[model samples]
Target: MKPVYVIANNIISPLGDTTEKNFSLLRQGVSSVRLHEAGNRSPIPFYASLFPETFWQHHHTTFTKFEYLLAQSVNKVLEQASVNPAHPKTGLILSSTKGNISLLEENAITPQLKAEISFTQSAKKIAKHFGFINTPVVISHACISGLVALITAKRMLEAGLYENVVVAGADIITRFILSGFQSFQAVSDAPCKPFDANRNGINLGEAAAAIVLSVHKPLNDAPILLAGGAVSNDANHISGPSRTGQELFFAISNAMQEGAVSAADIGFVSLHGTATVYNDDMESKAITLAELQQVPVNSIKGYYGHTLGAAGLLETVISICSLQENIMIPTKGYSTPGTAQQMNVCTVLQPIEQEACLKTASGFGGCNAAIVLKKQ
Candidate 1:
């Protein structure tokens, strides 16, 4: 298979708008999550990371908040690359669990815009805004949406279907999403502590991220390669993950095998640490099953919160930056061991010489995905 390289990328989060800015704040141990007062939609005070108020003032647009985020992220990448959006060989993939679902509230006021609430419709509109020629591909696989979208693009490129693929994912916090998680008792009142003894639950967040992949490498000093990816489902439960973590282990092992890497080769692990009791536990068991207990691991949930569909891609980009700078950011809010299986969780930002890292994510419906990224 032809190797796919990430030539350009961007992130629009509460911390910043560009990848460099975000990484700088991360290295300073700054977090975007904060306590937000309840609104008319959600009448409960909760913790989350929202885009700065000045963000919209700078990037003025008529699109909804969700649409603006997706468009802005993609626009940033296009600014740095020479790829033509209208080229037939170029493809667009949008990843989101709920695209403009918040617009449903406005249905009573403007029934004519009802069709725009569909995820597919929103995707098409975004593609048209960028003048993409081909139909946009949409991935809505819960939290794994971002990773699944990247994996899909890799397959498309390997099959000679597209020369360049742009994958963007974003999800904003809404009343519907907040209430649903609240009902599940999964919304933490305080900042989430992943792999911590006193951890409670997850704090929702909002962000959009994009990455451009191609067979040709860009003219840059640092280059990252997407070596392998794999997805698996345990069929254990709809809302709960596999109790034994075997299924997640399968996906991790397969991704490493396909990447021609081993447990000893991985420099660190970018975990899907939602800070939930079950999620952290399941991931630890899976890592132990894969015999990667000694590998350094960390989660960005405490910094960005859980951005739903955008979490995977956002963290992957940060991990790539970590590899380029040879520094590993610590898992924020983690004070002590919290999982049954012990693993090497980074407690502080450390500089080390490493080549490759594993990015893993598990979502609802027992879905799990893993991708191996190597620094070139």
Candidate 2:
């Protein structure tokens, strides 16, 4: 397979608008999650990370919040990449679990806007806005949507279908999403603490992240190579992950095998630590099963909360920066080991040279995905 490199990337989160700014905030141990007052639907205070009110002032448009995020992220990458958006050889992939789902609210309902509630329709609107010649590919695979989108982009590039692929993932915090998680009792009243002994539950967050992948090298610096990726299903339960970590372990092993790397070669692991009881446990067991227990691992959820569809890509971009800078940021809100397995969870900033890293994510519906990133 031909090498696919990450040529450019952008992140629109509460921490900042660009990748540099976000990484700086992360290194400072700053967190964007905060307590939010109950709105019309929610009756109790909840914790979440949300965009500042002034964030949309400059990019005002008729598009919904979700669309605005996607457009802004894509626009940022387009500004840095040399690919032409309208070129036939350039492809666009949008990843989101709920695109413009907020429009389903009673106040947002209107005859003309009704059709926009469809995820496909919302994606097409963004694609058309950017003048993309080909139909945009949409990935709505729950939380792993972003990683799956990247894996799909790699396959497309390897198949000679596109010279450049723009992958963007975004999800806004909505009352609908909040209520659903609340009903599941999966939301935490306090800011989430991943892999902490007293860790409670996940705190929802909103963000949009985009990355440009291509066979051509980047203009600024050497590109990070997407070496391998694999996805698996535990089929344990619709909403619950596998009680045993075997399925996720299979994904990790396959990803490493396809990348032509071994467990010992991975310098760090970007964990899918949602802070939920089952997720953190399952990931710890999976890491140990893969014989990567000693590798430094950290979860970015402490910094940005869980960005849903954007989480995977957002973390991947941050990992890429970590590889470029050779500094691994600490996993915020973790002070003690919380899992049964003794995996190395980064608690403080560590500086070291890293050649390759593993990024893994497990979402609802028993879906798990892993990808290997190698510094070029």
Predicted structure 1: lDDT? 0.90
TM per model? 0.97, 0.97
Tens digits of per-residue lDDT, candidate 2, 1-376, equal: 8999999999989989999999999989899998888786478999889987788786665678888899999999999896798998999999998888787774666777778787778778888898999999999999999999999999999999999999999999888998999999999878888998889899989999999999987665656899999999999999999888999999999999999898778889999999999999999999989999999999999888899999999999999999888899899889878886888999998975668999999999999999999977
Off by over 4 Å in 2: 59-61, 107-114, 219-221
Report every candidate's CA lDDT: 0.90, 0.90
Off by over 4 Å in 1: 58-62, 109-111
lDDT of 1 by residue, 108-203 (tens): 646556776777877887899999999999999999999999999988998999999999999998888888899999988899999998889999
lDDT of 2: 0.90
RMSD of each: 1.4, 1.4
